[model samples]
Target: MQGDYQVISTLLPLENPDHLEARGIHVVRTDVTKDVSVKELKDFLQKFTGGRLDILINNAGICYTMPATDTEIPNVEKMFAVNVFGPMRVVRFLHLMLIEAKGVVVNIGSIGGICPFVYGSSYNASKAALHHYGNTLRVEMRPFGVRVVNVISGEVSTNILKSDHGRSLPQGKWSSTADPAPMGHTDTRAESVFYPLNEEFQKHVHRTPNAITPNQYAEGVVKEIVKRAPAAWFWFGASSTSIRMVDVFLPRTTWDWLFGRMFNLRKLADGLPSQIKL
Candidate 1:
């Protein structure tokens, strides 16, 4: 049996503790966004592993649903701080150990990194930057026998929906009108129009149903790591495959048209009800 494998994250659910422990993984709590916390992690790694490090997975992330216009600069900075710079910090601090072991560094990016979407500017940009960073590092680290793998995931059933980290557009900002639906009555027209748009968006972006569990994602990660020569990139979950295909074959204008038709963005923008200023 392999000895303890050190894993660090901001939070680990108790329900999944046994899943990791079963694999002889020791969970270390650290804030990747903080320099002090990262240094502390380095110190802990030195003390615990005695200069031996194997696999490093940078999976900690947060998401929000805010329009680009409404997204504040500070929020963008915060997202980059956590999603982009955080992983770099870990890789930089642990480079020597990983080089010694010829270890792999796996960054958990998102499908949004490949396919940009509405109301996800900050989150998408951060992941996109991380993707590029990983790609560049892959070439640079080759001499040291360090493999940099970027994993792009589509929507899985996660706590991102509940989190307040991503951009948050105000009510009716993205909608056509505040009172598009009549009081006490549902708007079937809007639903009918938006459903296909949402589906088309999912087709391009690869949003997953509730079926793809995070445990399954974690298991896939383990499998990817075990490959004798792992892939430069891996996409897990249902949408992952489709999104990759689209990314390769589809043109930028085609994607833009698809997104525009699906979201009714132009319609929403033109049809927005006027606000009365006091």
Candidate 2:
């Protein structure tokens, strides 16, 4: 059967729709946070695909590297709006289409969900929620022959943390990894408790130089999607295997201790007020 591929992204530029359209992908402008945007996407798909959707990939996400204690509720809510509720909204609206086609729903999750990296508490929590949601979705959709796959993604080179985001990547520009985008919002709020640790946070948010290319990540994800019985959780992208091993073998205390020194949290804790000492 011929595949109908489409992408719904809030960030894709309308000025160059043909960039993806030339590859036969029908692009739809969608903001997953809003019900109206997702509903519009569903409506368009219903008409375009004859009320059947063979694959639904929830790939839109955002991240902030602020410490948990320093993170504003609005920022936390914003991440959840895109990272957690976005997939939930899409699945709710298009589940019937998925059931009709007995298709797959892939949630592009992050290894950050499993690994508690310092300064990424909100992003981690959001991804963890998505991962759990996808797990439960798999169980509920089984009888309908719909498979839900959660991709525990590792660091892939992307400009998600860059300031000038939403600019399309020029075609044929990918190498083993993309050029590093300058880290955006690398400083902590001056009045926050973690303000003194701004340098540590800056180091943490710096994109990994060893990250895989987007194309390499996509190739693995697509292979899992086309499987007759895809695994419930597929781990791919750079450092994914290593993170999986760490999650499986490391204890919580070990994790804390290792990360503490890695991000200078242990040093920071030593200088905190006596009353707050652990």
Highest TM-score, which number? 2
Q: What is the TM-score of each candidate against the true structure?
A: 0.77, 0.83
**In each prediction, how many residue pairs overlap at the backbone (N, C-alpha, C within less than 3 A)?**
4, 0
C-alpha-based local distance difference test score of model 1: 0.71
Task: Give lDDT: candidate 2, residue 272.
Answer: 47
Residue pairs in candidate 1 whose N, alpha carbon or C atoms collide under 3 angstroms: 63-166, 64-166, 66-167, 66-168
Poorest lDDT segment (10 consecutive residues) of candidate 2: 165-174
Any runs in candidate 2 off by more than 4 Å, and if so which?
1-18, 163-190, 273-278
Instruction: Spell out the clash pairs found in candidate 2.
Output: none
lDDT of 2 by residue, 180-275 (tens): 232333222233455456555565565454898988988889988899999899999887898888888877677687787877775666544455
Candidate 1 C-alpha lDDT tens digits along 145-234: 999899988767776665553212233333433333443343332322223234333443344345478888878878897676898988
Q: What is the lDDT of residue 263 in candidate 1?
A: 65
